[model samples]
Target: MKALLLAGGLGTRLRPLTENLPKPMALVGNKPWLEHLIVHLKQQGIGDFVLAVKHYADVIKKRLGDGSSLGVRIEYAIEEDLLGTAGAIKNAEDLLSDRFLVVNSDIIHEISIIPLLEFHRNHNGLVTIGLTEVEDPSQYGVVELDMSGRILRFVEKPNKHEAPSRFINAGIYVMEKEALQWIPKHKEVSIERETFPLLIEKNIGVYGKTINGYWMDMGTKNRYRQLHWDLLDGKFTLPLKEKEQGKGIWLGRNTEIGPGVLLVPPVLIGDEVHIGERSVIGPYAVIGDHCELGRHVRCSETIMWDKCKVHDSTQLNNCIFGYGLEVGSRHILHEAVMNRAVGVIQG
Candidate 1:
């Protein structure tokens, strides 16, 4: 079945990281964010994909380019203007199959689609929303269901005391083409706010299937950092075979380590990285491709993107670095996230 990936959302909460980058293009582990999501979905037998993109659409197009590199067939539904959730689906109407799957842009999960498909097929509901339990129901629209699994009502970010159930929208949905009737044309429509509620009010069948798996939404800076930490701690597994190179370190090709360098476990040094002598890296440091570090540099719990250079005696902890940044000698930073180039620094 065809899966529609919502890759166009403007990541307002994840600033700097998403300043020049699309939310879907944010780096997760060593691969592009969307790449990681697609690889996992592809492994679960998703045949084809439709990326509905608006913001930074070209960047996504340039990187994914027909999905051939990822071994899946991909088509783009480029929106000229901002189309909200249901509108995005409406814009891609021609590309969608009779039965399709819709996943939110921020969602990343390991949940299997087989059971959800089976549940959708067996039930009489025209729409099936995959539901997952979350500790904070206040952050997401809560799904309430009848005993038969038919959805009764949806509460939009209800208070914890007033919440009927802890199960919230996992942002994965199974829908029939007929459901498109509720979504009007040439307008900004939210699937969560508009379509599903109308379906329930019309006595149309809308069901919820409780799914279990590792799931997280990268919506903010804190969550993004937590995602990396979780991955490093083995809470979730990356799809690539090269993820676990040796002793919890994921090393890229042609990486050079200077003598007396200490690499702790759970470190990822990308391709062509050069480190000077006596530098201590990791126990959760993620150095992207072509990064250079001078002698006596200490970095732990840090993630630096490609081409970043750390000068001699610099120290970093809990920092996130963007592309092509250069730091002068003897600088120390903690809990910082950046995207622009760095200038001179002193102790």
Candidate 2:
């Protein structure tokens, strides 16, 4: 099957991180977030992919490189202007199949597509939206469904008291080519606000399938950090395989731990990492590839990107260090987000 990956968003909310890289390229488990999505879709029998990209389009193109190595045929639809969700898909109408899957690039979900496809085919709907129950529907596009699983109403970010249901749009949809007609040409059209609502108004078949699995929209820094914590806690599993050095510590290739270094469980240290003597790491720490940690350093609940250097006597908690960052000696960083261009130091 063919799938459309909407990866063009600027990710304004995830600033500093998204400032240098596109939202789809955000790091999750040491891999680009979009890579995880691709792998997940591939597992669900998707062999062809069309990436609709605008921001950092070249970076995405270069990294993915025709997708041949990943065993999929990948194509790109570069948008010249800002096209919203449905508009982007309309921009790639020539590349889409008669029926295709549409997925938002920033979502982290594990819903079974097999069942969703089954539901969509059985209902013969023009579009089928994947819905998941969220604790706060006010932050999402809420959907109300009838007894037959047909969509009855759509509410974008409704107030808590006004929300009719907790099930919100999960950003995954099975769409038929006929649905494209509802979207106009060369304009920013939101599927949630325009297409789906228009279909409902016309009494067209629009269905919602409430999925039972892990689902999250990693659009903010807090949720991004929480994703890593959840991974280490075994809440979800990625496709990558690393050697388990201890009970809950996963080590990559050639990782070196010095004498007297304390490694708590549930830690992930990437390849060629060097940990100095008397240093303590983890309980939810993810040190990326080729990182250098100095003696007497303490790191917990932190994510250090590739090639980061931490000096001696440094302590980090609830922090995120971007690639190649250097921490000076005796520095104590807590609740911080540091990168080459920006730094957020909170107590």
Candidate 3:
């Protein structure tokens, strides 16, 4: 099956980081967030993919070429203009000839797509949408479904006092080619705002498939940080194993560490990480590739990406340091996020 990935949105909510990256390219752990999505989709027997891109489209294409490495064939539909989700799919109308899956690129989750596909085939619906229960439906496009899983209504973000259900759209869907007929070409259109409501009004075959797994929208800095913590805590099922709790720490290949260092559990030091003597590392720190930690440094619940240097006596707590950052001697970073491209130092 072919899948349509909407990767064009400018990640305005995730500022600093998004200042240099599209949402899909944001790093979750050691790799781009989209890498997890691509790998997950490949494992589910969906080999052919089409990406609808606009903002920084070239960068995304350059990073993941042809999907050959991931064992999938990738084609791109670049939008010179900003098109809404439904409109972007309509733009790639020719590529989708049969039943297909569509997903927003910003979503991070276990990506267990087989059950949704099975649900689609079983019901033979024109469209089967993934829904997750949320605490507040007022902030989301809510879905009201019948006992048979048929969608009874698609409500826009309703006021808290008037919401019909707590199940919100998960931004993933299995759609048939027939649904494409409802989308207009080259116009701003949202699946939630325009298409789904019209489909329900016309009694089209719309169903909801509830997913039971880890799902998160990493669209903010806080959520981004939380995602790494969750992964380190084994919130998802993947090949990458979290280092055992209370195991002190596990440094990746070729790492160098000095004597008299105090290492803590739940810490991951990526390949070639350098640590100086007497440094105190965290129970929740993630040090990426080629990082250097100078003597007497203390870090806890922190994330330092590639090539970052934390000098002597510096302290970092609940902080995220972007790639290629150089911390001065005795500098303290706490609850701050630095963008790699911005070059702004945070204290």
Ranking by lDDT: 2, 1, 3
Could you tell me every candidate's TM-score relative to the true structure?
0.95, 0.96, 0.93
Native-referenced Cα lDDT, model 2: 0.88
Counting only residues 3 or more apart in sequence or on different chains, how many pairs clash (N, Cα, C under 3 Å) in candidate 2?
A: 0
- lDDT for each of the candidates? 0.86, 0.88, 0.84
Of 2 and 3, the candidate ranking higher by TM-score: 2
- The 10 consecutive residues of candidate 1 with the worst lDDT sum are 338-347
TM-score of 2: 0.96
Off by over 4 Å in 3: 159-162, 241-248, 345-347
At residue 18, give the lDDT of candidate 1.
72
Q: How accurate is candidate 3 locally (lDDT)?
A: 0.84
Choose 2 or 3, whichever is better by lDDT. Answer: 2
Residue lDDT tens for model 3, 133-225: 888889889888899899999788899778888898898999999998999888989888899888988998899989888888888778877
lDDT of 1 by residue, 24-136 (tens): 78877767879988888899888699999998888998999999988999999988888799999999999999999998868767778889999999988799999999888
